[model samples]
Target: MTNAIEFIHVKKEYQEQDVIEDLNLSIRKGELFVLVGESGSGKTTTLKMINRLEKLTDGEIFVNGKDSQAVSDRKLRKDIGYVLQQIALFPTMTVAQNISVIPEMKKMPKSEIKKLTYELLSKVGLKPEDYWKRMPNELSGGEQQRIGILRAVIAQPSIILMDEPFSALDPLSRKQLQDLVLNIHEKFDTTIVFVTHDMNEALKLGDRIAIMSKGKVLQVATPEQIAQNPANDFVRDFFKASLVKNIYDVYIGRVGMVQGYITEKPNQKSMLVDSQETMRAVFKILSKYEYVAVQEGKEILGYLSRQQVISYLSEHEKD
Candidate 1:
């Protein structure tokens, strides 16, 4: 499949100091690609280059196969959604108006914008009428973040870039939003480029994750692949610091996520759990019964068990 985005020998430097060193990557159409690294790893810098928020210091970026530089900044950005850590929803504006900012800029009809505002708010678990007149201050941080996400995708952009969008929220709220992003991705079939310092977030959300260090691409692989086999010592310890966190994120209602542990294959008789659900949600079922099948959409990846989960956690402890 033609990639939705491609980075070719990309580099960025300040005062002749390289921040992104010869980076190259490809993001497939409709797939969520995550960039994970410590601060100054250039993940955010890479995302900025896509929208021309930061001018590329070197190399080329192709969005939807066309050179990103070929498109003018204003027009290109109009087709791409962005959510920041702070989630800058205009404090003064009502929720509807906040969401309608870009659509209004695009000269969308008032009726259409109104329709879109309601649809988007509802999709993110808010009602239009209730929230239409509410200002940012009236909502909780989680609600505001949800609204910010709705605003980003109000235009239904083909690509969305998120920079640690949930890092500011409490763990429960963050998990909810992660589920929201997964839902949005399914609904829109969008190609997402998410940057995060959280390994658990990357594993939970990314179809593939690119791990970086000091401006270099250290490794790029699926969560299971990286967990089972890290690129090097840095990648190994990178996952280690958060090993318990990773297991929590991986196991919570999501046996399908860590499917490599399943010894028995799933079948029609197998108990079913949504791939998006977490281990915590289904612990009773797992403890009472021996296993439950983990599924995404219609496909069953495998069966999950509490024992296997406990065992996996023990093995990965690096004792």
Candidate 2:
């Protein structure tokens, strides 16, 4: 099957200098793809090139199997939704007006747009009746961001480009919005290309993550795959925070979820811990061995090490 979006030898240059060089990637249909990198790394440039917001200096970009540049700008943009970190909700417009912008631009009927406004607002947990007539100033930062995303997708675009949409919000609000996006993606099955420098966010939200640096892609991998096998030191350092956070999850959530997991075929010479054992118990076992294998019967779930536990706590403990 053809990819939802493809970049073939894509390159972007500014002031006779290349910002993106010989980049090639394919994002799967109906999956959330995340781009993670530091500033000046061309993640945003790559995104903008997809919808022709920025013309490619060289090479080709295909959206839904059609050359992106071959399509009319206005028409192509209408088929690609955009959400940003600083969500630009028109302060003069009411919530309904904001969400209805895309649909209205598509020349949807007023009646249909009205129905969709309510339906989508409700999906994001905002009651339409309470928020329908409220201006952007009246909504909280998080609420405004939600409305921005709602506006982007109300036209039912085939793809949504989210550029650090939740980066500006507080942690709690950011987390809420992340869950909402995940739900929205699952329900709509739209191809989403999310851009962020936050590794934690990338791991949590992406179906697969692409790490970029200096206009080149370092690795493209799933969360677990990347965690277990980083392509290089750069990729490993980028994901270190998320890896530590997962260790904390084990510390806090290790007990209850182990039910029904069984350990068998215990190699008499090997150090092992049953799945039912707590991380604290694993810590004690690790004192005698470099690491203790976590097994459920013949299946090896993973292993635990005292060094990993210490490393996890070192970051989490308040100074």
- Give me the overall lDDT of model 1: 0.84
Alpha carbon deviation, residue 314, candidate 1 (Å): 6.8
Instruction: List TM-scores for all candidates, in order.
Output: 0.79, 0.78
**lDDT of the candidates, in the order given:** 0.84, 0.81
Question: Relative to the unseen true structure, what is the C-alpha lDDT of residue 227 in candidate 1, on a scale of 0 to 100?
Answer: 91
List runs of model 2 lying over 4 Å from the truth.
241-312, 315-319
Clashing pairs in 2: 262-296, 262-297, 263-297, 264-297
Candidate 2 has an lDDT of 0.81
Q: Write the per-residue lDDT of candidate 1 for residues 145-215, one digit (tens) a residue.
A: 99889888878899999999999887668888999999999999999999999988898899999998898
Q: How many backbone clashes does candidate 2 have?
A: 4
Model 1 segments more than 4 A misplaced: 245-319
Tell me the TM-score of model 1: 0.79
